[model samples]
Target: MSATISPLAPKKYPKMPVIEGVRIATAEAGIKYRNRTDLLAMVFDPGTAVAGVFTKSKCPSAPVDYCRQNLSAGKARVLVVNSGTAKAFTGKKGRASTALTGEAAAKAAGCSESEVFLASTGVIGEPLDTNKFSHLLAGLVKDGKPDLWTEAAKAIMTTDTYPKVASQTVKLGDADVTINGIAKGAGMIAPDMATMLSFIATDAPIAAPVLQDLLSRGTAKTFNAVTVDSDTSTSDTLLFFATGKAGSRGAPKISDPKDARLGAFRR
Candidate 1:
């Protein structure tokens, strides 16, 4: 972690609210930084829908490829992310690392490997040693809680001066829903696609297809429009997860992109 927070950092961080059906945990795996967190586990409820946008870079990271392959499943139960190694350009070793990590995460979260998403960012071309943190996943999942958004964001930081987080509450029909997001980036950012690493979660009951449509459109106008150094990283990823917990509160399950009740959320 950077010793100094960015000058452009928010003057006052917002109090992040817990999103129902999502619990997070962080661990100091000693992947790179010492005495600070470097791994994050986000455990989701069963049937949670997922969507994502990744970098346009042809040489993407191992986790990027792994995530793209699993995105077709649309359902997610766990997300395991780490900092300190992009795990790009390491050939078969990178692929093996992701596989090991995925299997461990799936076992820990009690989900299938296809439902476990992964992301990593940091030194490129260096092979990430999954052994460093894969053994810690079970404990992380067991201790996960919903109020760890800030810690979760910090665990994924590389060169980032501070953890990036934001939240919003909106009405989906007459039911209230909340959205929370976390991101990490300091340099080598550009609008090739997502530009940086970000993960968002919502309590809205939206289908994966609708979430994908919303994420794609939102990226074009937001993350894809931003630039820093005109350079993009091999691990640029933005993933969105909808846990559908709001359905119990009267929020409608929206599978159609044109659903009228999503007006507030769409805006």
Candidate 2:
């Protein structure tokens, strides 16, 4: 996090409300900075659907590869993100670090390693010391709460001067569903895919395929439409998750992007 806030930042931040089935926690791992948060963990309720889009760079980060491989499962239970280490260009060591983090997150969330998602940003090429913070995951997940959107956004900052967060409530059928998102990036952003790193979660009962379609379409107008210095980072990533908790409130489960009920959300 920078010592100065960006002048373009919104003067009045939106009030973020709790999204059901999602809990978040942030910790200080001293990865690069001391006495400040550098790690974030988000635990989603079981049955949450996930979708993602990554950088177009030929040489992406290890965590990007890890996430791409696991995305085929279309299910998510835990998301672990950190700053101070991009974990790119480290070859085998980078892969090993991602594997270790995924395993630790899986163990903490009591889910399969394939269901755990990870993203990292910061210094590239240098090996990330997982030993510094991997053990803190279990405690973070155990104490996670649904109201840490701002803290979670702050924890993933690298060059960002201010935390980026957004929230909105939309009517899905007769039920109102909430969506919450956080992102980090101040430079190395372009139109190749994600501008930096973003994570979004919703309480709507949407299927994985539907969520993927929605995200893929929405990005063309959102992240893909933004630019900063015309440089794309190897760690650019955007992940979307949907916890089907809203089904109990009369929100119909949607599996197709063409569903008419999504008209309001797609707008």
Clashing pairs in 1: none
- Candidate 2 lDDT over residue span 1-267, tens digit each: 678888989998899999889999999999999988999999999999999999998889999999999999999999999999999999999999999999999999999999999999999999997899999999999999999999999999988998999999999999999889999888876866544889999999999999999999998888888776787788988999999899999999998899999998877
RMSD of each: 0.9, 0.9
RMSD (CA, angstroms), candidate 1: 0.9
Q: In model 1, which regions exceed 4 Å deviation?
A: 193-195
Residue runs of model 2 more than 4 Å from their true location after superposition: none
Model 1 steric clash total: 0
lDDT for model 2 comes to 0.92
Residue 220, model 1: Cα distance from true site in angstroms: 0.5
